[model samples]
Target: MEVETENKYLEPLFQDGSLYQNELKCDISEKISDILTTITVFGSVSIETSQPAIIYKSKKKIQAQILSAIPHHPKSIDTISISLRSKLPFPAISQSSFRGFTVSPSGFIVLSDTSQRLGIMNSCGTYDFIKKGLNSYNDITFVDDITVAASTINAIEIINLDSKLTERVISFHGICYGIRYYNGKLLCSVISKGIQMIQLSNGQITDLVKQREPENWSYLAIHDDKVYQTTSNYFVRCYTMKGEMLWEHILQQSKGVARGITVDNNGIVYIAKYNGNSIALLSPDGQRCRHLQISDTKKPWGLHFNAITNSMTVGCVNGTIELYDISYSH
Candidate 1:
């Protein structure tokens, strides 16, 4: 299930106020217009390991939502292995899974948020590139000009966007969760499997560090030879590149959750805490910056820092993206 849209003038529509959610399709240049989404879950959003939210910077605040539903009708696949449960066998009904977002270096942004609809968007408007028979890809990274990685549960795929195909780059035990490339190697986020580091030159995989104390995987970021990892509790742990736990910082005194993380050229870390409606900027030495704060009483999901302009971009769960200056004094 894929849907694509192509418009020659999405940018001007957003600029002229002719396309902010009402205009068929347009770029989200402001925080207030990322994506007007609706969420419906058959199960708990917290129970499952999901990447339902990701923050990125383009002309707009684009997003992807994960949905789960019971199949109305069952269909047989090419292969099926059944075992007895209690009174009968269980059937496998196919559903959908999504991966990380792809911010194109080529200035083309592709939105695969909902299955059956994949959007090729730019500042002007959008170009739809939806088709059937594509695998559910999770976690995307542009490795170089041609190579890209799409992570999923069973395999880590190196895909050629030019060819539009993927093959397993490596295999893992549990879900091959989130991944990011920093300083040449691929750092993978795992559920109960800790952080796995794979050298892209060769497919050699090794555990950089194992997650201790908690049974959940939230997010991971690498900067200044430190691996900043978070738990479901919004408790952040800064560990050495060797996986040594260095220090911990709690964004808020409460039991809230923090997901999105971005750092600026000044080594200031910004946190996006959902439902808390706050974005925090922390010094490289772990001190909170007094002036760099954005609070709206509604949880924010994504953030991006632009050093070129000395500003930060924020995305709210309530359908808005806002940019604020960190240079202002309190």
Candidate 2:
């Protein structure tokens, strides 16, 4: 999406005074209202808050309220403040189109681009290592501090930092998109084969979930012994390491496809919309906590969260990288 096109779609929402005011005035259930506020303020929000309340927020209007009519608890109205913080701009990590990115434990950023190049960026955002001539690298994961694994169209390539050499680790029959290293094995999404796990030591492939008729699984992440996979059909499905299906969430207004996906240590699932120029945060149980629109001109392609710095790095299709500091609590 271009800047003009994005503005054309968002202009009505920001310029229509009546429509904006009406949306702000609509009464929302207490539970949903609390969840929205909590997620907007803090990164994670609980889904257990169930009380009756009204929610209202506007950029042009200053109106806030909290009302309760329980016998012992009287109705209370208080001023609420919400602000959008400007994110810090990071130096360009790649000149070409990058499809996936990962942060190493030592703070190096490994980025893969459509030009069949994989480069590592230092903490100062300068390229420290660059390797070329690999096939379309889709996603990358760190097998260890000195070893990295990258997924290509039909195979997995293992690259060594010390030797600076690339090796074909395994070949797949389907298109590979997202990959992650978990429990000494590799968990990846193969479009025609579903989510598959490969034993790093023996190169044996195990089909965790068989692909169904209409679902196209693309990206995946691991957190708290659970695997989260995002599909091209705008759904995020959860599974156990053993292939047990847990839950699935269909993102509303997702623009028909989903892309980048990752999970925080707190079990917050972050997913990027393919062409929507937005990202959504979901709870562990598949509840929508927040939906964030990150760009007006470019689509967010890859996401990397640095727990040590409490920050997130978002890579856009236009070769723009942004760093944002995240708050864990209000």
Model 2: runs farther than 4 Å from truth? 1-96, 213-217, 254-256
Consecutive 10-residue window with the lowest summed lDDT within model 1: 84-93
- lDDT agreement of model 1 with the native: 0.52
Error of 1 at 72 (Å): 62
What TM-score, to 2 decimals, does candidate 2 have?
0.68
Predicted candidate 2, C-alpha RMSD: 22.2
Report residue 18 deviation for candidate 2 (angstroms). 78
Candidates in order have lDDT scores of 0.52, 0.70
Model 2 alpha-carbon miss at residue 32, Å? 77
Residues 1-330 of candidate 2: C-alpha lDDT, one tens digit per residue: 697686566556554432332212333454655774553432343333222243323433332222233334221111111122333223343444667878776777787777777877766656655576558788889999988999886799988877778855688777778899998899988876788899999989999888753243377888889988888557789999889999988887545357778776567777777577776777768855467665452677677666676566677676655666665522
What TM-score fits each model?
Answer: 0.57, 0.68
